[model samples]
Structure formats: structure tokens, C-alpha cells
Target: MGWISHLCLMNMKRRKTRTFLTILGVVIGVISVVTLLAVGIGVRQEMINTMIDSESICQIRVTGATGGKHKDRMILDQTVKAFQELDDVDSVYPFYELYVTLTNGKYSYDGVITGIPQSELTKKNYTKTSRRTTSNVKPVLVMGDKTASLFYNPDTDQTYDTAEKKKAESWIGKKMDLSFWDSQDSTSVRLEVGAVIDSGEDTYNRDSQSVYCDLDVLKSFLGRLPGGGTVYGQPLDANGNPYKDFVYSGAVVTVDDIDHVDAAVKKLQDMGYTTENEKEYLDTIQKYLKMIQLLLGGIGAIALVVAVIGISNTMTTSVFDRINEIGVLKVLGCDPDELQILFLTEAGIIGAAGGVAGVLLSYGFKGIVDKIAVKMFDLAKGTQIAMIPWELAAGAVVGAILLAICAGYFPARFASKLQPLDAVRNR
Candidate 1:
């Protein structure tokens, strides 16, 4: 073997501890990169899945039209009819909403009241936990759990420290007093709660301190005929009173197959309907993923830069320690190119070793992270963190080698340029 090649091998063996430390530094950096990327990807995928599962895979929301500046009834009717006639359209359900104050003795709260047709419930796939034995025009009302809980346990004091036991007791079978305001007057009604429903979504469930009753009851309570007359262009009562209109906040459209969601959304949109699907959520997630990748990569890059400095420092020290040996080799006719190559090869060896260790450490790091996540969030059961992508792992190995070579360059050049007389005499 050449003198320089033999010397590099001996140097590495002689300083085993330093070599190990350098490898450890690189390992930490690589592990950081892998773990961060994997976790970010996992979180984004999980969020998208949750959103899609809660809503239908392919759904659209349509808002009702309002008369330019004033509330025009005719425009709203025309817009609704236009959408209903679309070629790819499915069945449509309309709703009416009102905000009112409810009171039971001393406890009171303001909540939204919605009027929906029975068929709309089935179309929307709402699970009915309870219902009335008989269907009367104005007898039954369905309420969300949050609304039920409020009436079931009302607060008596300003601090809400004491429970209004009597008020809570009175709400069970009593009709709640609901007051609404008209142009300049107030009207009131009493409605009985027929049943309670539970939907898992916390945001919707909590704010849904909502009461659902039949359209007929809602019309009567609003001081309108069963079939309200067209006040603007909307169907109103015999006295020309307008029906309270509700914009479709959202709709869950079931497709023949899950795979057809994209096609169905396109078809609906082509027919002038707004759609929500995997692509919409996925695009949003991709933006966050890109940000996460940059942040994680930047952090990992800083660590790796530190490791590069360490490598440079280690090589510089090695060259100094072996100055006399380098002088002896130069004296014996070791070429400058040979000396440079030898040092570069040693740097590459260190990088390759670090890369191997780093990849192994990444796998272990991912496992630990997954375990910690499980303990912290108790997310979807049996979810496991994954390792770095193969392409990324390969890139890490190559990048490490390149960084090491760059760090070793100046030190190796310094050694090569040293005169044999100067190196030997100085030591």
C-alpha cells in the first residue's frame, strides 16, 4: 500500500474514540431529519382521514341567494330552482332557521331554532337516537345533547356556582317559553322537547345548542300561515308573510362508489354546485406539510453543519499530530495527489460509518416517537410511526460523504503543501 494510505488507516485506528464521537454527531442529525418528516406526513394523513370520515367523501354546500341589497323573495326562488334543475343534481333539501330566547322559570339561554323536513334527516344520514311515538304537526322537537344538558342542569347564581334544581326539574316535562322579535313587536311560543341526539363532532355538537322542529310549527310560531305567502319571491302565507329562509351550510352527497367522488364533484361543479372532497383537504394539508418539511429540514441542517465543523476540526488536529510522519513520507517521495486522496478516503470512511449508524438510529427514534405519541394523544389505535423514505435515507448517506470530503479538503491541502524540511524540523 502507499505510505499515505497506510498512514490514514493507522490514524483512524489510533483515535477510535474521536471517530465514534464524529459518527454520533452525524447520527443525531440524520435521526432528527427522518423522525420529523415521518411524523409530519403521518399527522397530515390522519387529519385528512378524520375530516373525510366525518363529512361525506364527496359533498357540496350551496348558499341561498339574497336580493342584491334588499331581501328579495323572487331571486331566492329562481336561484333554488336553477340549482335543482342541474343535470348531475341529486335530491335537495331546504331548511329554515330562527334565533330565539328560551326560558324555564329562572334559567334562560338563547339558542338557534331550525325547521327541517323529516325526509331531510334521512337524506343527511343523521342518526336518530330517540323520537316521538306519534307525529303531530307541532308536538315533537329534537334537540342536541348540549341543548339538553343546558336545560337539564341550569345555573342559579351569577358565578354559576349553584345548580337551579327547581328549574332543571321543571324543564323535564314542561314546555319552554321561546320569545322572538318581529318588526317592532315580540311574539312567544311554547314547544316540548321530544328527544335528544348525539353527534360526535365537538364543534358542531357544542354550538348546536339547537332545536329542530317541523316546518308547520316553526311557521305558526313565526306568525305565518302553514304555507306562507310569497313576501319577496319565497313562498309566504295567505297574508303575504315571508317564510324564514335558510342557506344550505353543507350537504353530504352519497355517490355510487367512494372512488367516484372526484368525478361526482366535477360533474356537480360543472352544473354550478360547490363541492368538498379529499382533494380540497389534501391541498390544504400539503401546504402545511411543505411548511413542516422546511422547518424540520432547516433544524436538521443546522445540526449537520455543526457535525461538519466537528469533522473539519478533527481532520485538522489529525494532520498536526502526524506532521512528522507526513514529512517523512514526503521525503520518501509520496506524491501530493496520493496524500490528498488518502485523507479524502479517510473522510469518506467516517461519513459512511456515520450514515449506517444514523439510519439505524432513525428507525429506533421513530419507534420511540410513536410510543410517546400513543401515550400522549391515544389517537387512532395501532397507529405506528414510520421510517425515513428510502430515497431520503440514500440521499443522507451521499450528502454526509460529500460534506465530510468538503471538510477534509483544506486540512489535506495544508498537509500536502508543507515542505519536508519545515514539517520535520518544526516537530
Candidate 2:
């Protein structure tokens, strides 16, 4: 072997501890960066799944306007007629909702009363948790588990008859008065309780305390039709005369295909009706996730820069210590370019070692993070922590090598330019 090659091998063997320590520093920095990116991607995927899986991705909601003393103004007949005529609109169901208090003697809690048609109810998969059948006479009402638990008494371990004194044997086949103020601010009729239904969703279950009879019952109570009408079952004109153009509060439209949600929404807007898609909310969520990923990746980048400085310092020190050796090689017929190449090769070796170790360390670090997070957050153990993308890993390896070469340049040049006599005499 040539003198420079032989010298590089000897230097590596003699400074094994320093070389290993520098490699370890670089490995830790790269591993941190990879792990952070992997976790961010996993979190984003989970959020997307949560948004798209359960609800109707292809559904759209349209609400009516409420003007002055007329709150259900949006439910006008003209609006429904126009929306129903839109292309690609599969089915439309009107909705009427009210807020009222449920009372059992001294105990009471506020709940929402909604009126839905049989066709819409069936399409939404609204099922009864307690009562199997809906009774027209009894006025069946479905309750979510949370709402059911609120009225539950620990002593009796039952809902209804607990401390509340309301004698509801079961949500099914029960009679209860639903008292609410009418349009003119008078207490309306007492609607009976019906079968309790379960939506199988947390938010829907908690918020939907009770959903009463179909739209017809709601219209009768409010003195209006599916679209807003008069208490006298007649339509009111702009001049306060009897008219026939009153509409309902809102409509829930179901589309045939989920992919057509956006197209359907646009069509409705063109028809002069407001349409909303679930993706609108998901897009807002994605914007926030992207910001978080950028912030986290930026933090990891600082650690990597520090690791580069460490590599630079180590190479500079090695070059300084071997000054006399380099001068002696030059006097013994070693070319100046050979001296520079030897030092550059040493820096490259350090970079390659670090890159390999960094990849291995990332896998181990991800395992630890997964175990700790699962235990602390009560997450399913099946959750996985992945390594950085292969492309990113490859890029990091190349970047590290390039950085090392840059860091070693000045030191390698200094060693190569040393006067043979001056370097030998100084040592």
C-alpha cells in the first residue's frame, strides 16, 4: 500500500474511541428526525380515518332562513320544490327541531325534540335501543346512552323511576308531556314519549336526548307544515293573507355515491340552495395537521445541524494531530493531492458509519416510543411506529456525506500545504 493509505489505516486504528463517539452523535440526531416524521404521518392518517369512516361522506345538509317572528322560514314549500328538482339528488327529508325540558316531578334536564319522517329515519339507520316498535298513540322517543344514564338513579339502578319520580317503565310504550312555547309564545301541547333509539355515535348519542314522532307530529305542534305554514293549517301571504307557499326548517339529502358529494353540493348551490359537505370540516383539520408537522420537523432539523458541527470539530482535531505525519509522507515522495484524498476519505468513512448507525437506531427508538405511548394513553397496542421514508433516509445519507466533505476541506488543505521542514521540526 502507498504511504498515505497506510497512514490513514493506522490513524483510524489508533483513534477508534473518538471515531466511534463522533459516529454515535450523528446517529442520534438522524434517528430523532426520522422518528418525528413517522409519528406525524401516522397521526394524520388516523385523523383522516376518523373523519371519513362513520358519517355519510356523500351526504349534504341544507338549512332554511328564519325571518322575524317566523323561525322556520327556511322550510318554505318553494325551497323544497326547487331542491327536489335538482339533478343527482337522490332523496330529501325535512327536519323540525325544538328545545324543551323533560320533567319528572322535581327532577328535570334540558333535551332536544326532533321530528323526522319514516323514510329519512329508515335511511339513517335510526334504531330503537329499548322499544322495538314505534307507537303513534304513545308518542315514542329514543334516548342516547348518555342521556339515559343522566336520568338513572344509583339506588334504584334504573332510569325513569329513580329519584326523578317519572314512572317510565321503559322508553317504549310510555306517556310523557312535551311542553314548549308556540310561535305566539304560548305553552303548546304535551307530546307523548315514544321508543328510544340509539344512533351508535358518541356525539349524536349524547346530544340527541330524545327524537319524538315524524314531521307530521312536529307540524301539528308548531301549527305549520314540513315547510313553514300557519297555525290555522293555512299559508300566510307577504301582506299577512292566507297563502300556500310555507316550507319546512331544513332538508337532509342523501346521494347515491360518496364521490359525487362535491358535485351534488355545487348543483344545489346553483339551484339557489345552501349545501354543506363533510370534507369541508376535514379540509380544515388537514390544514392544522400540516402546520404541526412543519413545526416538529423544524425542531428536529436543529439537532441535525448540531451533529454536523460535532463531525467537523472531530475531523479538524485529527488533522492537526497528524501534521508532522503528513509532512514526513510528503518528504518520502507522497503527492500533495494524495494527502488531501486520504484525509477526505477518513471524513467520508465517518459519515458512512454514522448513516448506517442512524438507521438502526431509528428502529429501536420507534419501538420505545410506541410502547410508552400505548401504555400512557391507553391506545391499542397494535399501533405501530414506522421508520422514515426510504427516500428521506437515502437523502439524509447523501447529505451527511456532503457535509463531512465540506467540513474536512480546510483541515485537509492545511495539512497538504504544510512545509516538510517546518512540520517535522515543530513536532
Candidate 3:
């Protein structure tokens, strides 16, 4: 080691208790902040994963204004064509939802039905068969996994059991009677069950508890006729006027890349349409996470500030105790810069030691937290509730050392400027 470093070490060794206590203060500060920030990052990531899936991240929902002059803007085919022309848009699919009653000979179900483009539905693993039907038979429809359980056998007066639930999967190839109330008139049609789709584990799936069909088929049954004549079986409204133009409930705009989802949402909002996207939700969540981290960092800063004060006091006391020693060194031609360097090195060693120990302790603490999370919260396997990146570890150590050096700055400067004779007399 260099002579200055050796001297610095010997000085620290002379007051082992003081050095240990000061370092302990810094360690406590670092560990507290690191652990808190780690938890924040972990929770943020887990929430994003749980609440948002790939389908949600890449799609934006647009709905028309209700009870306004421009309420019909989002329902036109021209709007769909315009969305398709947007720079990042991949496709625009019409969205329709309506309450309907479904019945087999022995069972009946009442639920909402949704209509989407068959090609888009297939891409999301909605069904095993991807082929579009060409036959002129009954229109085929897909059923949600939960929609099957909504059926009750009125003849047997029973709901589906475990075994019967499994049998409901075979309903994909059967025929069913579909009926719905269009205003005051009721309409019924025979639909061929093409598939029963599992909507996965998300809390809300557009297909869950709903039947899926081609957009045109659903419109023909539930929407105003092409000639503006009748809506399903309803010939006129309560006022005896022809029905209004058919309008889609909403539109799903698929973006070519997730990075462009926010920009696309902004454009849609500018057109006065209501918009929803997971990206916007995630941005709001991230803001809250940042605030939480800032609060935690402030708490840790208090401890670190106390540690800095302790370090300053210790160095000042050392300068006074070593007045005679410093005088002797000056008499032997020691430079003022060298004297400052020696004292600063001693303080840095203390902070560096604390920082490293703090990092190790933080990791150990993280392991304990993850264990508790797994046991109590039933967090998914391999999900980390505390994440410490390498950047954080390195930053903690470097930051601690710099803080210690700064705390010792005035003390080191005072000692360096002391006159040899005055220091010897004071000692």
C-alpha cells in the first residue's frame, strides 16, 4: 500500500469503536432505502403483469359520444376506414354487445353477446379451428367458457356439475336457439355452435360470459336493416318513426407496435371519442410508484444525514487529538495536500465498508420478504417482491463513500492549514 493509505489505516485503527459506530449509521441508512425501493419496483412489475396481458397492451377501445350531436361519429364505416389509415394502426374491428337469451331443448341461458372479426378472434386463441366457414347453413357462433355454465337444465332443474361442466365443452358442434329483445319486438334465430372459447385468467375478458359471432351476422339480427326499414322484428319506434342508423357499440383499434399505443390513443381522444388503453393505466400506476419511492428515500435520508454529522464530528476530534502528531509530520516535510488526503481517505474507508455491508444486508432482507410474500399472499412462484438491480448496488456503495468524503472536507482542510508551531503548542 502507499504510505498515505497506510497512515490513514493506522489512524482509523487507533479508534476502532468510533469508526465502527459511524459506519453502522451509514449502513442502516443504505439498507433502509435499498429495501424500500426494491419493494416498490417489485410491486409495480407484478401489478403490471397481473392486470395487463399482451392483448390488452396492444389494443385501444374507442366508443362514441352518448346523447350528443356527434354521437354517431364512431359508429360509421368511414370511421373504421379512417382508423385503418392511421400510421400505426394494424386493423380496426367493430365491437357490438347486446343482452340475449340462448336455449337448447332442455337448457336455457341469459347473457350478453359480443361480436368481433373472426380473424382477430382466432389470433387470440379464441378457438381451435381457424378456418372461415363458407357453407350457407346456420351462422356459427363461439361461446365463452363461463357462458356454458350459465345454462340450466329446466327439465331436470339442475345446474352443471363437475362432469356436466366437462360435457358443456362438446356444445361446440350443437345447434341452439338464440333470441333477444330489440326495443319492444323480440327476435329469434338458430345458431350453430362452432367453438367454446377459454378466455384465460384475466378478471375481465371481452369474450367471457358472452357469445362471439361475425360482426355482420350480429348487426343483421340486432341492428337497423340496410334499407332503414325495420330493426330485427321491430317495424317502428314508440314514436312511429323509422329506426335510427345502426351504430356499433365500440371499436377496437389494434396498433402495429405497443410503443405507438399512447400516440394512437391521443389521436382518438382528439376526435372527441372515449378511449381506453392499458398504457394509460400503467402510466398512472408508475406515477404513484415514483411518489412512494420518493417518500421512502426521504425517510432513509434522515438516517444518512445523521451519519454524515457523526463522521464530521469524529474527524474533527481526531484532528485535535493528533495536533502534535500533525506538527511532527509538518516538521518532517509532509505537504498540506498529503495531510488532507490522509484524513479524507480514513473517512472514505468507513463509508465504503458501511455501503458494502448494507448491500449484503439488503439482499438478505429481500429474501425474507419474498418468503413471506409467497407464504401469506400466495404470490406466484418465482415472482420477486423485492428486486435489486446491479445499478442500485453499485450506486449505494459509491454514494456512501462520496458522502463520507464530503462530511470530512472541512476537518481535513483545517488540519492541512494548521501551522507546525501552533499545532505543537496547542497539543
Best candidate per lDDT, number? 3
**Candidate 1 TM-score over all chains jointly:** 0.69
Candidate 1: pairs in clash: 73-232, 73-233, 74-233, 228-236, 228-237, 229-236, 229-237, 230-236
- Evaluated against the true structure, the overall lDDT of model 1 is 0.63
Model 1: C-alpha RMSD to truth? 6.0
Q: Give lDDT: candidate 1, residue 87.
A: 49
Query: Between the candidate structures 1 and 3, which one is better when assessed by lDDT?
Result: 3
TM-score of each: 0.69, 0.73, 0.78
In candidate 1, stretches whose alpha carbon ends up further than 4 angstroms from where it belongs are 1-10, 37-39, 56-58, 67-93, 103-107, 116-120, 123-128, 131-136, 148-195, 201-293, 324-338, 378-380, 383-392, 415-427
Q: Write the per-residue lDDT of candidate 3 for residues 76-147, one digit (tens) a residue.
A: 667788888988998888777667778876678877677776576565455444244312334477777666
State each model's CA lDDT, in order.
0.63, 0.65, 0.77
RMSD of each: 6.0, 5.6, 5.0
Q: Candidate 1 or 2, higher TM-score?
A: 2
Clashes of each: 8, 20, 0
Task: For residues 1-427, write the lDDT of model 1, one tens digit per residue.
Answer: 4655576778898999998898787777777766777777667666666666654444444432333333432223345565456445554444566656776666566656766666644333233433351245453566664553454233433311145322122233446777653323354557676555555544453224566766544544444422234321234434445546533323334454445556667765665445555556666777977798788878878888888888888889888988998898889998887887878878877887787788778878878888888778765557764446688778888888899899899998998898999989977
Q: List ranges where model 2 is wrong by over 4 Å.
A: 1-11, 67-92, 109-111, 123-128, 136-139, 148-173, 183-213, 216-237, 241-246, 254-277, 324-345, 384-406, 409-427
Relative to the true structure, candidate 2 has a C-alpha RMSD (angstroms) of 5.6
- Candidate 3, residue 349: lDDT: 89
